[model samples]
Target: MLGCLLAADGTAQAAVSESVFLDEMPVVLSVSRLSQPINEAPAAVTVIDRDMIRASGFRDIPDLLRLVPGFSVAYTRDNTWAVGYHGLADAFSRRFQVLVDGRSIYSPHFGAVLWSDLPVAIEDIERIEVVRGPNAAMYGSNAFLAVINIITQSAAQAAGGLVSVQYGEQGMAGLLARYGGGDADRRWRVTLSTQDRDRFEDTGPDGSGNPVELRERTHTYFLSGRTDWQIDPRNDMSLQWGVSQGDWRGGRVGEASEPARRESGAAFVHLQFHRIPTPGREWRGQIYYTRNHYDADALGTIPGWPLPVRVDDHLVQTRLNLDIQSIQRLRDGLRAVWGVEWRRETVESPQNYFNQGTLDGELARLHGNLEWRVTNAWLVQGGAMVEHHYYTGTDISPRLAVNYTPLAGQTLRANISRAYRSPTFFEQDGNLVYTDTGNNAVNVVTIPAGSLLKPERLLSREVGYVGQFKPLGLEVNAKLFYDTLYDYLGSQKLNTAQCNEPGAKKCFQSVNGSSLNLRGWETELHWRPLPHLDVSAHYARVRIDYEAIVLDVTSTIIDDDLPDSAPRNTFGLLARYGWDAGWQASAGIYQTDSITWLSDGDKTTGYTRVDARLARRFKWQGYGAELALVAQSIGNTYSEFRQENLFGPKVYASLALDW
Candidate 1:
């Protein structure tokens, strides 16, 4: 399936090169396998342009994702959040890949991303591209479900100083500022930004469900610099570097305990040479290092001495591309892209904790892709990748895509691919210790390590259509997809005797589960009746069927068939209006159905939320200023997350901002 997709993409690349310019091209959202416009892609793509971000009045990445179709976001507790696409979801680990400026941000320790820790400022984002299907052939593992890339604005375009301040109810307050500029000849720019948010209260169990007093705080700082040096008219070299830090308090177990604190930092340097020796060729290289640390000292009577865990990772990658349209047949242009990557990870524990043993592992991958144009209306693309993990062995992934354009404004796309997820240290060999009080003394229960876990694989197929009409100023897009899982790694209870030695009642370990099926569809509509008025709506439905399985002890089929942290029905709406007088008003509503909790029998209730914003801008000689107001949860709807395992309080807000 992957091989065919790669071949089709190669064909499309050949056909598209003649009509599109690399610098001026618009990228598709869902087709992360290729960097091409939506009209020429063979998959569902949703492009969230910069204008949409500004009009939505979102102050953070999570808020902005709510407007995207086929995605669901839920707060676990405190400042932690779970976001997923299609149907697959989990509290600590989600099956998706996230990138910022072509760098993977998913944590290797937990196989998930900390959405709150994303460093780029919302105001500096140029666009967000979301692909809602498997992209393993191009993006490698962790792209089993979907891919989300947050592209930031170039330094040249953001050359000014601006500041924004806002305060609202529920102890919410925020500030963001940036200053950047460089001479035309020098072609250099620098920016620095910081964001802070106060902890929000949760719903208590007082029947009336009043706000619970849980203190939480989060902050992030970022600095980036870039310079461009033109070697000649046909050759140019650019260098860029970015560094960011995020700190947050959450993951508390009880009211008497101190909240968990997590800190993460990243630094990256990239160099690129475009139009080197060839007319339409480019080469790029990057090196990055990241560190993530978590301290959970107040967890379950652990005392003031926190359990500390840290991960340090380093990666180096390079890519080279050749566009052969000018030398080859005009209709048979050939484009090829290839790259190599290397990564190393090291983990440490402060308390001599050996459960998750500290180890260093290395990985290497060789990947290449090709695009070919078969005809004016039909194009094909294909690609394949091979990777070797020192501990998990080697695996191959491939993809195929076919795109057909029946009319100038209509596109039909189909894709098939295979992807896999590598096992983490926690899954391979980790020990967990839990304690229970017996007569004022702690009774420790130890969970032994499991060394037999295997990697998970998914085969996915999808088809979609996109259309744009100028007569009604309307755009509509829809997609249908199906995915099958094999060797899905899940934790299951072993025989009672495994841990029944006079104390514990249960023993659990990692195991391979039966195959599962996931199918879903998403639809979105956008209408602009007037130049200044815009309205949009979207809906998503996902269905999952877990095959029956027998418990190891009872030998009876498990009745529950729900996937964890996944909602069945989700929808959203947005409306915004901007006046010539520099005044803007916006409002939005979002709703999501309750999700099952960790394959357990528990369930969470659904809730609806509303948000509103107002802003105005004033211009002076060589400078401009802006003020804004923002509010979230205006409806005060009562909502619970993680199947009632966590809940949020009704919040009201008003904000004053000046820039």
Candidate 2:
């Protein structure tokens, strides 16, 4: 595989550099900095462009993420998915942060992301930047493991009409349509899409039995527009707005219930001003506002039992940046960014289901960062953030990093940072009832208000190396990282009868206790061995350990095994061939090691699964088109998340047209 990639690299470099080399290509976005070249950034940043998305023929964001190093996707149901990265899995993956055009996508209620809700259109996405490390100083909380930023294309690039349709196994159907065009100077766009899938019967390891049934349906609509006004020779102002809505359905376990539905949406508006301060200095300022909402119905319950809940949230932020060169010396420069932000949220729960509650709260933060170039080959960056929450206590985070470029196309980088995760309302004052065999009874769990719940802190360190050779047309990047968590927030069971009357039943409290350690390594390689062929592959491994603790004075230590949801190893590979006649063909595969879930002292064995896709593109008259064939679960592996089950099946073909 490596030899094939290296040969293709030499051919591709000779073909592109000789004809299409451009000096002003926009550098992809990075988590360590606002935006910087992939090699210049002091972190491991992965970029998946729109062309790659189309060639892969992936159906959604979760599918596309399989190609990224150190990432895995686990499905809870037909329409719900959990993403794990850098050794952290679901329910425990609070360390990662996700954003879409600078707007937060991580759910504050559960501290996890529902990948299906993110509005990702293959045509609208410009690129996805995946950064592996702690970025709390630049992105605030929930950035201890990694950061994923999805950036959309400018309106100018989407000024046309396009339509696509797909159908496959289990009565699955998908439809998408988009149209937009404006004056040469101003542009706008709109898109509408819907997907529906009939439930499939689940099977056991041997693939035969009466399995559970699962089904799902979803519909989404989006509208956005942008305009640029050239006010002067040195200044230009731009305005943009976007809105989307989604509806979903599915099933629950151990009960007969109607499909649960949820609706979520967001609106954003931003204004920016740029000016030249001096001969080689520049400054930019921006202000924006965002609003989000989520509503869901209870899982399984009697008809008309009243099971509905809603969350409303709003955020306002302002940022300023300055770039100066030769301020004090000929080779020294300074780059600084600072900002302030505020957020308000409200929740309404009427059914008292699923940890329902009614609460309103606000939070504010001040953050800034500065980068300095001490020498031609050495660079340093430092930053800090201070945040205050209405219910949770204040927190301060700091970060430092360095980059050394010993030679052209060869770079080494390292980073050290301190980050934190604030306690959620559900962890502070909510009440829940849970059943445990160890306690031999149903226990009511309640967290007391006004109790000290310190923010979960992490001290992280990373080292990486990246090399790009023009002659070989190959790019290789590798990194290793470790993190130690203090005061990690986790649930613990207590015996209420010990303090109360002997006749009372035992109860437990979901309180904060114990610590955890996580470490991992990731590698990504890109090679264009031939002018018509390209190959890319990624591999990652992670491990996690939670300290032992005594519950109810039994002096029992929690198991040392990692979380059940995190996979120890994951890997993916893609091969593509592009022809001069607009003909394209590609095939790819993704595999994940089995996962183990522990319950009642029982450990489950893990399994592995595979998927593949093939596609072709062509143009006729004034329209461009593509057709693809996809087969998911090529090995037909059976898997389950919690009580929900899934079976791998084949998805047939899809056709797309654009003008």
**Number of the top-ranking candidate, with lDDT as the measure:** 1
Question: Compared with the true structure, what per-residue lDDT tens digits does model 2 show for residues 543-646?
Answer: 77775566557323333344544567878887778777667777677767766532211222344545556676788677898888877767665554443355
Off by over 4 Å in 2: 1-26, 91-93, 198-210, 217-245, 253-332, 351-357, 432-450, 494-509, 554-565, 596-609, 640-644
Instruction: Give TM per candidate.
Output: 0.83, 0.81
For model 1 the local lDDT of residue 562 reads: 47
| Tens-digit per-residue lDDT, 343-439, candidate 1 | 6766555222233446567777767667777777787888777877755689888888887887877878888888888776545543343432321
